[model samples]
Every structure is written in structure tokens, then in C-alpha cells.
Target chain A: MSHEELDQLRAKLDDKNMELLKLLNERGNLVKKIGEVKSKAGTKRFDPVRERKMLDLIAEENEGPFETTTLQHLFKQVFKASLELMGEDEQKTLLV
Target chain B: MSHEELDQLRAKLDDKNMELLKLLNERGNLVKKIGEVKSKAGTKRFDPVRERKMLDLIAEENEGPFETTTLQHLFKQVFKASLELMGEDEQKTLLV
Candidate 1:
């Protein structure tokens, strides 16, 4: 097995990681925007129905070496963090 | 405020999640391939130096509503999972 093959594969993995990074940050920005809208509308940030729907969609679309449940758990962690961020926004609004 | 705005943003968020799903599975596949090569070459699967470099790159690139530290933590969780997956491949080879 050529070291070159391993090196090339690592490069590709790095590229994928960067793509993931961009998407995650983009998603974060969207969540913040949504937070602003929700704050204005006086609507609560956590919508269980929508969260469940998103998780279901992920489970349906997953074709993976990682199990659907594992991915869901990881995604939920990010989603929960996003919720906290929204809460932060709410707190800031209250302060201001 | 039209509910339509919230719904549209939700749709975009879902799209971003799907993209993340695809990239993660793609990364998993690459890691598995790298595991095979490493197994054949008698090299260890986890390379801390490479891992550190990748994390550093991510920290550098993070421009976020999500802090760089938060992104790094989230990424490390996924990376650890990938490492476990590589271990699974190694085990299957030994079993075979």
C-alpha cells in the first residue's frame, strides 16, 4: 500500500471536513436569523413538531456507515446548542 | 410577520442538515478506505499530528456566530466517531 494513497485519501477527508464546517456555520447563521424573527414575532424558539420532522427526514435520507440514530444524536447536540444561542439572543433583547 | 418566512428558513436549515449528512457519510467511507490501507501497510490508524493539523485548520477557518471553540468541540465528536469506525474495520479484518 503506497503512502501516497493514504495521503491522498487524507486530503479528501480534510476537504469533506471543511465542507462540513462551512455547512455547520451556515446553519448557525440561519438559526440566528430565525431567532431574530421569532423574537420579533414573540414565538418560542423550540418547536418540537418541526424538530421531529427534521430528525425524521434525516433518518429517511441516511445511507450510512454511521447508524441513523448516531447521526441523529450528533445532530440533536448541535440543534440543542443552536437553541441555547437563540436563548442568548432573547436574553440580550431583554437586556436592551 | 408571515409564517412563510419562518417556514422558508426552516426549509433551508433542513437542506443544510441533509448536506451535512451526505458529507459525514462520505467522510466515513473515506476513513474506512484509509483503514484498509493502513491495515495492509501495518501503520496505526490514528495519527495525532495529522489530527491536530486538521483541527487547527478548522479553528482557523471558523467565522461564526458559533464560536471557533464550539465548532471544534462539535467536530471533535464527529472525528472521534470516525476513529471508532476505523477501529471497527480493523476488528472485522482480524475476525475474518
Candidate 2:
């Protein structure tokens, strides 16, 4: 491919990457809000039933170019991490 | 209080703490299993609606000296960490 074409493709890739980052950041903020509510309510930090439900929801919701299974696995991890950022008690409980 | 009585109380406390640890570990193992299933299934993790449901369940079930809200917050944190141990993709997605 021509150098100009290559450069244009690279720019497009960069833009998509940025979009992903922005979406992730938005998710993080929402999760953080959850954590705050949880903490203030003096509640326990983990809920497995909910986590399982999430997977089911994604399976239901995905209109996939990617495999359904792939999306489920990927989002499972995403939700997990978002939980980490959101909950301090979870961090302590796991470590202990 | 006598020294011997104090020592006995200390041992009781230790025993209770150990029991709590054991229960937490058992929960951890179960969550890890959930993680594995989610990964294989290609599912998303984290369900706020489910989390709310859990708190409601706890409230309904508790015969409490401690408040229902307190238990909910604490368990929420626990579930979050279990997710971290289980899912790799989530870790990457969050960091980026």
C-alpha cells in the first residue's frame, strides 16, 4: 500500500482506539458511583448472582460481529475490574 | 478480669475469626467457578440489577443484630474481588 494510504489507516486505528478508551472511562465512572452508594449503605461488597445475571444479559443483548461467547468473556472481565475500582472493602476482604 | 479468662476469650475470638476466614475462602472458590463458566460462555460480568436483588434478598433473610444494608455493602465488595481473580480480559479493558 502507498505511504499516504498507510498513514490514513493508522489515523483511523488511532481514532477507534481513542473511542474505546472513552467508553471504558465512562463505564469506570458509573461503577465508581455504584461503589459510593454501596459504601454509604454499609453493605457487603460482592454479589455473585448479579454477576451471573450480567453474563446472561450480555448474551441476550449482543448482536455480534464478534462471537457471542467472546463478547461475554470480554465483558465479564470489564465488569470485574470496574467493581475493583468501585469497592474498597472488596480489596481488603480478598487480601485478608 | 483474670489472665486465664482473658486468654480464653482471646482463643474464642481467634476461633470465630478463623471460621469467618474459612467461609470467605469457600465463597471465593465458588466465585472462581463462576468466572470460569463466564469466560467459557463469552459472557459479560457485573449486574447492578442483580446486586440490588441480592441486597433485597439479604434484607428479607436477615435475623439481624447487624443491619441488612451493612451486609449488602460488605458482600458487594467480596463479589467484586472474586471477579478480579477470575477474569483476565476485564483487567486489560479497565487499565486501558
Candidate 3:
């Protein structure tokens, strides 16, 4: 690819990154809301059953150069991060 | 909140998860394209300057219950996953 072509590709990648960031934050917001409900209901913070279902759904939707295993692992990290954010928000609420 | 209210929140979270999944796969596709360009041009796979700039940009855009530090850490994981996918794709090409 020419230099211009390469730069354009990088720009596209940057746009994708920003989109992912926004989506992740949206997910984080939902996680916080769920955390509040969980706290109120005395439910566990981590739900393995739901996590497994999520992984299954992601694998079904994956049409990728990325392997299913890789997608699973990446999404597990995303899930973990969201959970951490939820915990942090919960702590903050407790402190207030 | 009532059980119905909690269930509604969980359903919303499930929708967010699907949206994030689609965005992540889109990112993975872009990463593959960028990886191809990097391989052809003999450029480094990892770019720390770009990574740092990305972090800074994300922090600036962040209006969050999640802290800047949390966003940075989460994004780092996403970046790492993208790099891993790139590397995997490169290796597959080499093997072919």
C-alpha cells in the first residue's frame, strides 16, 4: 500500500478504536445499573451462568479472522473490566 | 427494585454486550488490515507513541462514573487484544 493508503487505514483503525471506547463505556454504564440491582437484591457480584451464555452468544455471532477462542478470551477481559468498573461504582456509592 | 425491574436492567445489559461484541469484531478486522500494511512496509507492530496518544485522547473524552485510570487500564486490555489478533493473523500468513 502507498503511504496515503496506509495512513487512511490507520485513520480507520483510530475511528474503530473510538467507537469501541464509546461502546465499552455504554456497557460500563449498564453494568453499574445492574450492580445496583444486584446489591439491592443481595445477589452475587459475579454470575458465571450469565457469563457462559454471553460467551456462547458471542461465539455464535463471530464471523472472523479472529478465532472463536480468541474472541472468547478478549470478551472475558472486557467482561472483567466492566465488572471492575461496577465494583468501583458500588464502592463510591457506599462511601457517599 | 422489583424482580421485573432487575430483569429489565439485565436485559438492557445483554443488549449492550451484543453491541460491544459487534464493535470489537469490527476493531479486530481493522487491526488485521493495519497488520497487513505494517508487515508489507517492515514497520514495527507495536507503536508506543500512538498508544500513549490514544490513552490521552480517551482520558480527555471520558465523562464517566469510571475513572480515567479505569478507562486507561480497560483500553490497554483492548489494545493488547487487538495486537494479539494482529500477531496471530501475521503468523497464519507466514505459515501459508
Candidate 4:
């Protein structure tokens, strides 16, 4: 590719990466909200049933190059991170 | 502060942040290993009991500006991330 074309391609790639990061952060925020709901309900922070439903929804909705398994893995990490933020108090009390 | 001093301080801060990231990643890997052991033994993936023990150890070992609760929060996030990576397979099967 020409120099200008190469630069344009690099810029596009950077934009895509930035978009991914933005989406990830947004998802993280949502997870935190979910954690708040669960905690306030005096429910267990980790809900395997809800998580299963989430993965199934994603799998059903996905039109993807990525497999359901991969999506599940990525989102699981995201969900866990959210839960940690929500469970800060419990971590100290329960763990210590 | 002099420009030189400011630059040096910024560099130190960045270095410290990098060090923190490195330690976090190292801990993440260890958690994954722990998860493997837990799964093989049919132990529960999320261990609140062990986490509390960890916080206590850190608190006892700490001579620090950061409070025990703060450490607990940060490390809890790290541990959750590690669990997510380790539990990828279960996420799909269990969640779906």
C-alpha cells in the first residue's frame, strides 16, 4: 500500500480499538449496577442462574465471527470485575 | 519543583504504576492455577473464606498509607478477573 493508504489503515485500526475499549468500559459499568441490585436485595453476589441467562441471550443474539464460548468467556470476566467492585465490603469482612 | 524534578517524579509514578500492573498480572496467573486445582478437586470456584484470609495477611504485613479495606477492594478485583479467565469453559456451559 502507498504511504497515505498505510496511514489511513492504521488510523482505522486505532479507531476500532478505541471503540472496543469504550464498549468494554460501558459493560463494566453495567456490571457494577447489577452488583448493586444483587447486594441490596441481600442476595448472593454471584448468581449462576442470571449468568447462564445472560450467556444464552448473547449466544442467541450473536451474529458473529466469534464463537459463543469466546463471548461467554469475555463477558464472564467483565461480570466478575463488576461484582468485585460491588463486594468490596464483603471482601474485607468475609475474607479476613 | 524544577522542571527536571517534575519530570523525574512523573517517571517514578509511571514506574510504580507499571510495577503494580505487573504484580496484578502475576497474581492473576496464580489465581488461574488455583482455579485449575479447584476445578479438578471439585471445589467451589469462588472461595470467600480464602479471600478473607488473604486480606488479613496483607493487612498484617502492611505498613502502609493504604488502609486494609482499600487493599481488600483492589485485590478482590484482581482475584475476580483471574477467576473469570480460569472459568471460561464453565461460563458457556453453566450460563447457557
For model 4, what is the alpha-carbon lDDT of residue A2? Answer: 38
Q: Rank the candidates by DockQ, best first.
A: 1, 3, 4, 2
The candidate 3 chain B region of ten consecutive residues with least summed lDDT is B62-71
Task: Report model 4's TM-score to 2 decimal places.
Answer: 0.45
lDDT of 3 by residue, B33-81 (tens): 8888888888888999989988998888877766788778877877887
TM-score of chain B of 1: 0.92
Off by over 4 Å in 4: A1-96, B89-96
Alpha-carbon runs more than 4 Å astray in model 1: none
Which 10-residue span in candidate 3 chain A carries the lowest summed lDDT?
A1-10
Between candidates 1 and 3, name the one with more favorable DockQ: 1
DockQ score for model 3: 0.63
For candidate 3, the per-residue lDDT at B59 reads 87
Whose TM-score is greatest here?
1
DockQ of all candidate complexes: 0.78, 0.02, 0.63, 0.02
The residue ranges of model 3 lying beyond 4 angstroms of the native Cα positions read: none
Ranking by lDDT: 1, 3, 4, 2
- Candidate 1 lDDT score at position A22: 89
lDDT of 2 by residue, A1-96 (tens): 334443454354334333333344444554554555556566554567756766675566544333346545555555666566656545655699
User: Model 2, residue A24: displacement in angstroms?
Assistant: 35
Candidate 1 lDDT, tens digit per residue, B22-95? 98899989989998888889899888898889889999988887878788888888888888888877788789
Report the lDDT tens digits of candidate 3 across residue range A1-96: 356777898788778777877777877788888888888888888999989998998888888766788778877877887788778877888899
- Global Cα lDDT for candidate 2: 0.51
